[model samples]
Target: MTNVVIVGAGPTGLTLACGLARQGVAVRVLERATAHADGSRGKTLNPRSLEIFADLGLAGELAAVGRTHLPFRKYFEGVFVNETEPFAGARRSATIPYPASRWLQQPQLEALLRERLAALGVTVELGADLVDVRQDADGAEAVLADGRRIAAGYLVGCDGGRSTVRKLLGIPFVGEGDPEPVMVCGDVEVEGLDPGAWHQWFGPQGAFMLCPFEGSPRWQLQASPETAADGTMVPPSLESFQRLADTHTGREDIRLGNATWLSTWRVNVRMAERYREGRVLLAGDCAHVHPTAGGLGMNTGIQDSWNLAWKLGHVVRGLAGPALLDTYQEERLPIAAWTLDVTSAGMAAVVKGIDTPGIGVEVGGVGDFTGLSLGYRWSSLAAGTPAGGDPGALLRAGDRAPDGPCPGPDGAPGRLFERFAGDDFTLLVLGAGTRPDLAGLPGHVRPVRVEDRDGEVRRAYGVTGEALVLVRPDNHIALVTPATEPGPVHAYLARLGATG
Candidate 1:
């Protein structure tokens, strides 16, 4: 029996496998596709995801393949709007360390994750699709398409929206809010059009967006009508694309290269009622499906894996209680829901040109929609906050912490996060009050003083005013206290099966 068996080898599955395997957990990933997908569907990594990659020691590698400030270059009716600014000042004063976000294509991101998993001796079984699943108290069994059975302590479904594992488990994805139905998505190389900017023509002709790809900085066009379509478009020959480009952008003389791939589909904002049932759990699109408005699908899914991987590691290794696993749903469900709402709203707002009041009009420098700063407030793990009540005070236990580089112990500065970047449980104390008490907790527990930068840790946790904060293994804040006391801290640890 493997320690874990994951279905799907996209970013979420590959990330989870690498995270678990690094901790010496045996993981097997089953992918239905013959090889990794080469689609350019998802193209942005929110700040939180960049931090998770940093923690996994792949930050430098990820940075190498990614370009910055893609989100900054957004548009409205063929005009430039706002672009993200350099996070220099804030990063210089951060408590936790890392970049806010990096822009990388989906195919490149998946390829890197797969490479990381390979380095850890965890290779995925391509062409191995999950035909059925059976779960009991002892373990969960996965029957593949070829009639092969594999047993594991736990099973996670990171498959796309139409998840076979979710279906086999009989989990119903309840919500569906898809108002704008028409979509025109394709990856093509076009000449004469500006490759530096992402343009959107929002007038009556319909909405169209163009994002630049990594190679040659060519643009990938994504357009939509008021209605959704289920038809596929043949890859346009260079001549054909140029003709279409002329019609859309009004550059008749423009030369368009052959499209790599072209297809169209509607976007939806929906999610599963629950993230888990019995020993089976879901992550990424399987658990929730959000609109591509902010390109949150891949980023959120990567964050989901980051949250669940650590808990699974602990539970499988007998380091944390099974209850710790429950926090995964409690914490991530709200984030997923919020993401769906925001993205759905953003898409709707764009389609109808509804002005979001008091939320600012631009996207960079104080006006941007910082997808990385999300925090959780409602869960047994996070005590007392509006979202989770007093029980959710731990920042947003089981949630992702936004990135900000901080000073290191050495005279030279480093990230406030470097201490906990080793894939272990981290305890962040914003003040000196609880550092000494939380110290000497355990080998897995590392405590850091959040003094160099005020509001740095707070911002990362999405806590407006809180002194002491405890983050979970997955980088989510677990507790927040006006004062640091050992009792609640110990209780939190004990709940995770941590011992004195």
Candidate 2:
């Protein structure tokens, strides 16, 4: 029996599989599709997801194959309105190393993740659809389409919006769908169009958009029909796409060529009432479905699996109790709810003409979309109080651990992120303080004492004196307290049963 069985070999399932396998946990992945999915549906990878990829050693590969610094050009009634690169002004700061988002076709991104998982000696079982699932106290067993029963300690549904696991679990996905202004999107080749910019056209007819997909000759084509008889959407086709372009842009010079993939999308905003039911859980589109306005669907799913992987690993290893797994829903459910609102609001703004195309649609600013601003301040795992005093102090428990330059083992220069590269809790000790006793610490927790030589680490962590910051396996700050008082740190771990 495998330690965990992940359904849906998309980005979420593959990411979780890799994370758990890296920690020496046995994981199996299943996909209902007979083959890998292909498309540019979710192309934009936010900065926070990039950071997670960096920890997994795939950042370099992603950056190499991804496109960045592309400008979004908007036009109205065949007249050029304006152009702006939302992330152009973004610069890498001391704490935030990656500030720009990258665009890579979803298929390419999934390929990279699948490659990494293959290296880890795990292969996704394709054509193995999950027919049903049943769970008991010890573990869960899944029924496949071919009548094969596979048992695992845990089961995660990463399958898309039409999640069979969610339906079987009977989780209520409550929300409303936009009735009007349906969109048809697909990958197509075009002539007489510059691939340098994300082109958009909003006119009396409707809206049309074409974004260049990096590492390919195809562009992602999205358009809203001006008129659908009886509110019926037209089937996706090259001719239909050309008609949308010609109608919206009022130009016949541009031509649409072969199409690789095409599909119709409607605004169906819904989220699962809960993320987990006993040993079975949900991730990605299985848990939440929202408009693709902010390009957050896939990114959110990636983060979901990343967050769950560590907690699940701890439980599987017996280093923590099963209750620790509850934090998965506790920390991620709110985020999913928040993201839905953001995207729905963006859609409403577009409909009301209050927001410009590709601008002001993000949940916050560009920083927020990068996933860095997301934190679990209310999570049961997060514990600590701000030291209070420095007005610039921002570090707190349940926040992302800011990356900064620090002293290395030989008193040379290193980075805080370097210390948190592994799937272990990192204890970052700032300034000259008595190192916390690690002999009693759990084996999953790694302690690294850094001399705050230039006050860089101290400033980043908002610590004036000796302090200990407990960084979780997922790189979020779990506890922060003065080194003299390590009781809270130990206590926090004990609550999760992390202390051996």
Candidate 3:
């Protein structure tokens, strides 16, 4: 009976629920677990994710808890080698406000999102296991394990790598894992180690790492996965961790105990063949998974939810056609593909060179791990994107919209992000010469006339005088055309069925 029934309560599901609930969409988030997930899953939040969280009004909260300048200290046989700051020389301009990444535990991020969802009048329904998903042309029904059926206009699967909804839907998750387990990971208390830096010890055998969590006594311990003679990965334990430390670091005095969230990780890289299946769709790990090296899993999933939330909200609210839902896959599926390739290569590099294996910028195979360069230029929703370039403009349609200084509603100076905030399409009419053909636009479109104050707005967007840029609710550019020729804007809205 709700507009959306989101499966799983991880960061992806919670973000979707928050976006929809904020837009007055009746949303229900069902989680199979009885409580929030624990462990230091995907501790790094990239710059693009910071921008999303900022839009969600979590910038201050995340900054308060996030460590932006954690340095990676390396060692060889427990002997200090060299240290490196991952985000050294990162730039921060008006366009890239959150230029650096932050390290915060996954559970803490989930808690913040859950708090935001509660503020929007929606709570995650835990202890609810989905057994089946059925959908017709009109709506979808989630069949719970306890014989409860929750019907909604649409359903999204945001579950983890082993997604039940995806399996039930028969969507093929095509990819492979390493021949054996790649690493053993857990959160444990380490004695005789500095909790200030990410301590790593590399040897001829393999590499062992223990990253200290902010304001916590426990550290995330990762080491080469132990295999039995029969070739089965040995389960993680404090004793196993101690053995790894002793073998790699020759540190017999250091003790490890109070282990939690123990598990073995593999260099598994897989993605759903498709993101959408009829009225049901998948996001986050439900759609794709990456290797444990770069911590790109949760960030990719959260961005997937961000991309889908607004489109699904529009369709459910009768503001756009069902075809709009197809763009979700068109846009995010390619991103998943890119993430898998880069992260897989990065993991391989890490395994091949353990003595001085690279991290962050050194490891990303093709692009940066910050998730800033991701886009969907091929999406059908990205209308009016020309084949050629404007020498003066650096951005095209479907690019992540950069933030910059501009005039507010009352002609007061403000940033573009303030206008882009909320669940609405921001139509930015820049400069005095731009045309004002705002009639028949959808009610969700918020048109703002900016003076381009001090040329900051134009510089960030890389646009010239008299330009109209339509930004999507997820803060991606939908269309960019000259103000003199505004037909593209109207035509694009017409294609989206957004005309009033």
Candidate 4:
């Protein structure tokens, strides 16, 4: 029997397999496609998402191949309205190890993840689409397209929006489609222009976005034509793609060459009513799908994998209770909802030619929306979170703390995220006065103090005001109280099956 059977070999499934395999858990990822998924769906990596990859030891590779999308621009009717770079303070505040946000192609990003999983000896079965699934108290079983049966301690569906596992499990995905789907995406080589920077053209012709792909001057184009309804139904042919480009840019001489991958898809803003059922769980597109405006789809899926991987591994290893898995849905579902909201609003603003939506901010790191700086508010562990205020406050016990750099007890420069290296629990202490005596806590719980030697790390966590923030192995905040006694800390761990 396998420890975990993941249905889908996209970034989410591959990432989960990589994380679990690093923790010595046997993971099998099944994909319906005959080979790795190579598409041009999402092209940008939010700063926080890049930090997650850094913890997985792929930051160097990601940084090497990925392009930093500087000078973000907004155009109105083919006219430039405003342009700005990434948050400046974010680059300066890195007591953490990774940069804020960078842009990389989806194919390269997925390839790197698959390579890491392979290096760890995790095998992904391509073309083995999940046809049927069933779960019991002991384990879950999946039927592949070839009529093969695989049993595992748990099964997670990371397949795309049309998820067979999700359908077989009878989970209702509650959401709606974009009434005006104004996004068309495909990868093509431009013959006459240097694809070194990101360019956007807006106006009566709608909006066109082009970004440079790695190792070539070729560009990936995403746009909405004024004549086309919702950027959907454009034929996936070279002639069709060039025609759309011509209509948007009004350049008849532009030839779209090297038509490697092409597809026209509609954007949906939907998520599952619930993310898990018994021994079965959901991640990636299976759990939620949002507009591709903010490039949040793939990143959110990767985050879901990060959230579920550690607990699943621990439960399978008999180190944590099955109840620990409940936190996955509780913690991630909110993010999916919030991301959808942000993307929906932003897309509406962009389409209407609005220069500054509430989501846009200056370069000083005031409003970051990669879901990296977001905190948890609605969990049993986060009982003290302020009610009804802006939910994006500092990290609480049940929220994932933003990662930055910190000095270890050994005085070595360490990242707050490095604690999640290969998956382990972390306890973040704010004030020296409130550092609970953790001598009696479980050995796996890593206690960290953000008391002195910095202001950004201190302010970023809001621990000075709130006291202590307990972070889970998956990086979700587990608790937040104003310098409480050790009782709540001990109680929190016990509830999650942590033993001293």
Clashes of each: 30, 0, 0, 18
TM-scores, all candidates, are 0.83, 0.95, 0.95, 0.86
Return the TM-score for candidate 3, rounded to 2 decimals.
0.95
RMSD of each: 5.1, 2.2, 2.1, 4.4
lDDT tens readout by residue for model 3, 88-134: 88888887888888988888899999999999999999999999999
| lDDT of predicted model 4 | 0.72
State in Å the error of residue 401, model 1. 5.3
Off by over 4 Å in 2: 179-181, 226-231, 354-367, 388-393
lDDT of each: 0.69, 0.84, 0.84, 0.72
Which wins on TM-score, candidate 3 or candidate 4? 3
Relative to the true structure, candidate 1 reaches a TM of 0.83
TM-score result, candidate 4: 0.86
Candidate with more favorable, higher lDDT: 1 or 2:
2
Candidate 3, overall lDDT?
Answer: 0.84
C-alpha lDDT (0 to 100) for residue 320 of candidate 4: 82
- In model 2, which range of ten residues has the least summed lDDT? 358-367
